[model samples]
Target: MASNTPAPEAPFDAFGGGAGPAAPDTEWNPTEGSLRAENRSGGRHRVVKQRSNFARSSTVLGVGVIAAVGAGGLATAQEKPPVAISLPDLPDMPDLGLPDAHDLPGVGALLPQENHETVAEGRANPNPLTVATYATDDERATKAERAEPVADVQAGAGDAGEALRARILQQAEQQQASADAADKAAAEKAAAEKAAAEAAAKADAAEKAAAEAKAKAAAEAKAKAEAEAKAKAEAAAEAERLAKLGASYSMPLSSYSLSATYMQSGSMWSSGYHTGLDFAAPTGTPLKAVHGATVKSAGWSGSYGYRIVLELSDGTEVWYCHLSSMTVSAGQTVGTGETIGRVGATGNVTGAHLHLEVHTAGGDGIDPAQWLRSKGLSL
Candidate 1:
């Protein structure tokens, strides 16, 4: 049996070289054979395993890179500053070549034109070019085009110009009306004030005139009362004088007989002078006043114990002396032949008699018998 022949090789199995029991069929089937079988065939399978391991590690590294990039994006989102948007600044505007109201189209033509005149009238007209003007494309248009019928443009321009003019005129008229109303109101107020003042003045004048009339009436009444009082006093005085004249003529003293005359030098006294007239009547002969007169001196004198002097209306002074007693007082009025005193010889006399004397207002003594004769008395 020692023949030089290799032992018969064992039958190879697809799963493993050792055929323990045929491996059970699994549900997973691979397109390649087992790894040990393929390795035994060649190293190509190890190379393929190494390449798959490298590919798996590279996929893990790529996943880690993507995670890191995502985390960095979240951090940057949290750390970013808030955005502040700003607007651009503008420059100041410059002046452009623009005209005032005066230098535009159509306004110069529409305004009233000025004319020359003398300066004495003191009138002036506004500059026509000072009027306002409209801004429009038609202002720059040709004259022929402007004159043409451009639908509603010509009509609108004419209406607008007319409306502006009408508005200005209406405003001016309103202002004028307001001014006129104010002036009228002021004039009416002034007129009312003047009328009131005039009325007050007239009332004052009337009051003054009434006061003057009352004063004049009072003065006239006073004057009339005084005149009546004066006339009554004169009438009473005249009646008293008439009554005295009637009483004086009724007495009988004018018929008395004179026995002796005063101032006779017949040794009747120690002085050798008779000083009175001797009536030579009984003791109670009634004396008489010579005329209508006042008894001015009726008291006693030193030599003639009691005496009486009668003052006539014409101021002739008569004296009745050698009285036993006086029956009249000073200022007592008496009529002619009225009893004044009784006869006595209390003074330097030897017989009872009356010392009759007369003195004029001029202070000159005269004979009493001569004075009685001058008064139309027979005594």
Candidate 2:
């Protein structure tokens, strides 16, 4: 059997087919490499190593998923209508560090060329490079075109929301100020009402006090007037009592000077002391009876010349001596205050005067002044 190991200097076939060696530092093209056949022996196939575009494509797809999630969340948050995105067509990009496809073996069909003969003949193969590009320059152009109008719509929504928030804050401030003003007005009204009520209460109290004082003063005045009326009535009653007593009694002489009293000690009398009351007057002065009486004797007697004796109804005797003359008989009756005789110096002579004496019913002499006073007479 032949050894299956190839020599170390042999060229590596990346496509698993016998082909020419690749140039140094050049990347293989997929459109040319994938069309070659694989070498197989028995049931085993040869393992071929080639560069793939999967790493770049997977990175682009992951970025696209993240970008899509962010865009969906922004749209839901804004809650705005979607706007169509349009962009101006960009100029063709300059090539990167790649050889011309025309120089590469069997890669001419992968690039867009000016020739359309194969396409018109319906024999052109599908180019893998132009298939759905995940991280190609053409994809970046499409994303930019869609994002322009979205940014404009988001900005407009933000401005409108800011204006609405400002208006709400202004309205709240105005309402608060109005409420404060109303509260202040209500408090002021309540205070004014309280002050007025206090003033009214004070006025009522003062009026009540004044009324009480007036009533007290009136009561006092009435009591004083009643006392004065009672005093005047008592004085009038006393005067009436004195008037009744005056009609029954009187003094013997209306005008006279007293010379001697009853029982006065002197050497000029028969008993060595005066036993009668003496009244001095001018000669012929009238003498009157002291009370209602009847004459017991009216005659001249020695040492008692020209005297008269009178007897009262109660059997009391009164004698008038030293008279100038007599004017009544022994049996004549006389009333009180009636003129009976005259005054003169007679019998036991002295100056012209009247000497009066009194005796009780037992014929015993008493003080005449005291006896007259007992009968309600002022001597």
> What TM value does model 1 have?
0.32
> lDDT values of the candidates?
0.54, 0.62
lDDT of 2 at 319: 89
What's the lDDT of the predicted structure labeled candidate 2?
Answer: 0.62
Give the residue spans of candidate 1 off by over 4 A.
Answer: 1-257, 267-276
Q: Clashes in each model (backbone N, CA, C under 3 Å)?
A: 0, 0
Q: State the RMSD for candidate 1.
A: 34.6
TM-score of every prediction relative to native: 0.32, 0.37
Candidate 1 lDDT tens digits, 1-379: 0122211332122223332222244222223567567677775332111123233223333433432332232333223332211111111111122221122232222211221122112323345422322223324545454344322233444455566678889999999999999999999999999999999999999999999999999999998888888888877876666555554533324334577786778865566766455565544466888777898889878776678888887888887777877789999988766788887776765667666777888867777776655454545
| Residue 128 local lDDT, model 2 | 25
Please state the error at residue 191 of candidate 2 in Å. 66
